[model samples]
Target: MAISPFRIYDIASTFLQHSLHLTSTLHFYARSKNEYSHGIIYVRRLSMNLNDYLLNKHLLLVDDEQELLDMVVSILNEYGFYNITTAKSIKDAIEATQKLRPELAILDVMLPDGNGFELMKQIKQYSDCPILFLTACGEDEDKFKGFGLGADDYIVKPFLPKELTFRIMAILRRSYKSENPIVKLKNSQIDFSSAQVIKNNEHIQLTAKEYDLLSALYRNAGCIVTIDALCEATWGANPFGYENSLMAHIRRIREKIELNPSQPVSLITVKGLGYKLIVE
Candidate 1:
C-alpha cells in the first residue's frame, strides 16, 4: 500500500513534537512515495537542550528494511535529529541525494537488489559529505571494504541506537569543525561558501582536494605562500607525503579558474615552493 505523503508527514511531525519533545517548527513534505522530508524545526545557540538534536543539520537514512528505517529515524529524532529523509531503495536513495543533498548519509550495506557500496560511489561523484555505513555485514573484510570506499565510519548492526546516534554526532562534529570557509573571489562572483565554486553565474564543480586548495589560495591571496604552507593548510601538519596530491589539486583548480591552466595567469607556481592566487 502506498502511503500518502501528507499522512506520512503528519505522523512524522506529531511523533517528533509529542514523543521526542522537539518543538522544532517542522515542515514535512512528501517528496515521493518512498521519500519524505522533515525540515529543520528550530535553531537556538545558547540554551543547549534536546533541541540540539536537529538544528541546522540534514541527514539521509537509506535502508531496505521498513522497521529498521523507522527505528533509525525514530532514534535520530530522539536525539534532536528532526531534519531527516528516508529512502527504501537505491532509486529512491539517488533521488533523495538530488533533492535533499544531506550533510551526512547513513547507508545499509545490502539493499534488495542494489548494494550500498554502489550508492556510495554515486554519492561521492557529486558530494563529499561524510558517509557512515550502518550494515549487518560486519565481517573484517566487509568493514575494510566500506572504509576503502571512503566511508568515514562503519557500524555493525544490532547495536544500540544511542551508540549509533553518538557515532553520527561525532562524525558530524568532526566534519563541521574542520571545514575551511570558502573565499569569495573577484567580481562579487564565485561563491565558495560551499565546496562547489560558482563563477560567471555558473557552478564549476571541484573535487574535495581542489576545493580545499583553492580556498587556501583565495584566503592567503597576494602573499607568496609556500608549498609547505599550502600542504599544511589543506591536510594539516606533516603533508610532505601528499605533495603529489597537492599538485594535482592545484592543477585542477587552475583549469577551472585560469584562462589556460597550461599557461596559468591567476594561480602561479613558485618553482621550489608553492602557489599563489592573483585574483583579477
Candidate 2:
C-alpha cells in the first residue's frame, strides 16, 4: 500500500524527536503525496565514520528561522560535521560564502532578504559547491525551479535528520568521489580504488592482503588499530595465528609506502599493540 505523506511525516517526526532527541519545538511540515512523487525520502546505510575525511568539509546552511538553523546545526554536529556556518538571510549567506567557500550548502527557498534560488546563483558565482534545497516550499514548480538552477538536491522541510544527512552525504560522495579515494602520505600515496601506491612517480601494486591491511590502517589513520582488529580486517573471522603473517605484510607495505622501510615513519608500529598510518 502506498503510504500517505502525512503518515510518512508522522513516522519521521517521531523518529527525529525520540530517536534523535531533537527538541519538541522542531516543527515538521508535510506536502501532499503528489508533491512527493519526485522522490524526497532518502535513507541509506552510510559506510562512513566519525573520522571520515568528508566530515571535515565546510558546510553553509541558510535558513530564516533561527530555531530551525540551530536544530539543523546541532543534528549535523552530532553526525560528525564540525565546520558549519549558518545564516538567516541571503546577505549573510553570500558574505559567509565569500569568506569561506563551503564544500556543500543547504538552503531554504524563502529567505527574508531574498529566496534560495537567487542565493544559489550568487554562491555559484563564488564557488561551485553542491547545493540542497531544504524548505517549506514543496510545490512542483519550486522543485523544478531549484533543480533547473543546477541545485544538486531538493529536500522539503520538516525532514528526518537522517534523510537530510543522507542526501548531503550522497551529494558530497557524488561530487567528491574522485578525490576521496587517494590517501596521501608523507612520502607516498595509496589509491584504494586502484589498489596501488604511488611513490617516486611509480605505481606499486598491493597484494590483496596488503591492500586490506593498509585500507584498515588508513581508515583509522593516526590511531592504533589492535593486532586482533588488523587480523580480522585482513583475515577472516577465525583470525587466530596471523600475527607473524600480519607483521610480514606490514614490512612489505612499509617498503612500498615508507621513505626508509627499515625505519618506517608513515606506518609506525605501536610497540606490542598494533600499527598506525600517518597521512600527509
Candidate 3:
C-alpha cells in the first residue's frame, strides 16, 4: 500500500505526541511506500534525545531556495544542531566542503548553476560524507540517479519538520556508528552509553543537563569550549541567560567526574573563557 506524504505526516505527528508523556525513550518505527516506490521509509519518533551525542556534527545544506534554507535551518536549530553551513549554489557548496568537511550533506536537486547530482560528485572528491537529497524532484529517474551516485537518502520537498529531523538523525546514526561511547578521565571514566561515571569502582549517574554539558565538553576535549558554545549545547538554540544555570551544572558535573571539585585536575575552567575536559 502506498502512503501519501500527508498520511506519513499524520502518523509521525501522532507518535511524536504520544512519545512525550513517557519517561523512558521509545522507538516508534513506521514503514511506508511513496510514489517513487522507495522501499521501507523509516520514520522514527525523536524521543531518545540523541542530540547530546550527535549535535556537534558538521552539516552542509545546499539549496537554491532561500526561504526553504531558512526554514530547514530553523528546524535543525530547534533540534540542537548548531554546526550547520548553508550554500545557495554548487560553487559555494563545493567551496564550503573543501574548506571544512561536513559529516553529512543535504542537497537540493535543482540549483541555479548546477544540479545537486553534480554537486554530490564534486563533494565526493573531498569527503565521503553521507548525502541526503532534499529536493523538489520526485521523479523515479531522479531518485535512481541520486542513489546510483551514492546518495544516502532522498526526501521530496514540502516535507514535515519532524520527518526531516528524524531522517537526518537516522542518517547520522548509520554513518557515524563508530563513535566510542566511553570517555576516560584522570579519576573517572564516563560511559555515555549508560550515562554513568565509574569512579573508583563506584557508579555515579549523571543528570540530563550534566550529560549534555559533559558530552559537549568531551567533543572538544583538551580545547577550550567557549561558554556560549557550552550553553547552546546544553540549553538550546537561544542560550542567553543560561550562564548561571550552566555554572551550576558544571559544578555538579565536577563533583561527579573530579576527585576534588574544588582543586580540579580533570575538568578545568579557563576563568574568562570556558571549561576543558582533561581525559586520560
Candidate 4:
C-alpha cells in the first residue's frame, strides 16, 4: 500500500523521533526532583502525540548472553516498542516465536545446545516474519552462510547500536514492500520474494545485504563482473577509495558458494584484479 520511499522514511523517522523524545523525557524526569519529578504529564502527552503514529509491530530477540540480550531489549524499548521479548537459548527462542508470533526476530548464530540457524529453519515452517542475525562471527563465509540460509539482515558483533537500529528499520521496510522476491544461484534457490532460501528443500534466513550481493553475482554468472561492477549494482554507486566494501561483499559471497572462502570455487577472485562467477 506504500509506494514512496520518502513516505516510508518519514514514517520511520517519526517513529524514531517520538521514541527518542519519550526516552529522553522519561530519563530526564527520573533524574529530576521537586514538582517536575511528576512529569508524567509530558510523558503521557508525548505518548498521546505518538498514538496515531504507532505501528502495531512486535519484535523478538534471541541471544545466549544475558547482557547483550538486555542491551538490545533496552534499545528497542527506547525506540517506542512496548511489545518486546528476549530468549537466551534456542529452545526458549522457539517457544517465544510460537507464542508471541512477533513481526520481526533478531537472532544470534551460535546458541547454547543448538544453533540459531537450525531454529530459523523451523520458524520458517509457520512464520514468514523477517529475521536479522546479530552474531559475533564477522567472517565473510559466516555472513554468506547466514544469508544463504535466508536471513533478512546480518550485523556482526561489536557493532554500533545506531547502525543496528538503522538496519532493523531498513529490513522492516523491505519486508512490507511486497512479498519478498527470491534470488537464484547455481544449485540454490533464494526467495527474496519470501525472505527465504532453499537448498535441498531446506530453507534458511539471510541478511538484506547478503541477499543483494548474492543476487548480483547470480544474475551475472560466469561474467567477469568487476568489483566496481558489483559495487554499483548492489550499493547504487561506487564510492571512490572505498574498495574495501566491495572486497567485503565478495568475501561474504564466497563463504556461501565456496567450500572454503579463503580458496573459493564458484566465486573466484581475479587476483590483483576484480572477480567473476563460475556457475557449474
Q: Which number leads on lDDT?
A: 3
The residue-by-residue lDDT of candidate 2 on 1-280, one tens digit each, is 4444422121225555555443322222222434322222311111224336576667898898878987887678556564567788889888888887789999999999989999999999999999999999999999999999999999987799899888888898888877747888999999877899999999999999998888767655555566776777678656689999999999999999988999988999878667778887
Model 3: per-residue lDDT, tens digit, 93-163? 89889887888999999999989999999999999999999999999999999999999999997899899
Candidate 2: 10-residue stretch with minimal lDDT: 37-46
Off by over 4 Å in 4: 1-20, 23-55, 177-280
- Point out the higher-scoring one by TM-score: 2 or 3: 3
Q: What TM-score does model 1 achieve against the real structure?
A: 0.51
Clashing pairs in 2: none
> Candidate 1 or 2, higher TM-score?
2
TM-scores for all candidates? 0.51, 0.55, 0.57, 0.48
RMSD of each: 16.6, 12.7, 12.9, 20.5
Candidate 1, position 23, lDDT: 47
Range of the 10 consecutive residues with the lowest summed lDDT in candidate 3: 35-44
Please give, for residues 66-98, the per-residue lDDT of candidate 4 as tens digits: 788767766665554434567778777777778
Best by TM-score: 3
Model 1 agreement with the true structure over 1-280: per-residue lDDT tens digits: 4444322122225564565554432323233333353322221111233323233367888998888887787677566565578887888878888876888999998998689999999888768889999999999998999999889999998989879988988888778875544444442233555567665667777776675676556544533456665676577646578888888788777667665678877777877656667664
Query: Ranking under TM-score, best-scoring first?
Result: 3, 2, 1, 4
**Evaluation by lDDT, superior candidate among 3 and 4:** 3
Off by over 4 Å in 1: 1-54, 178-280
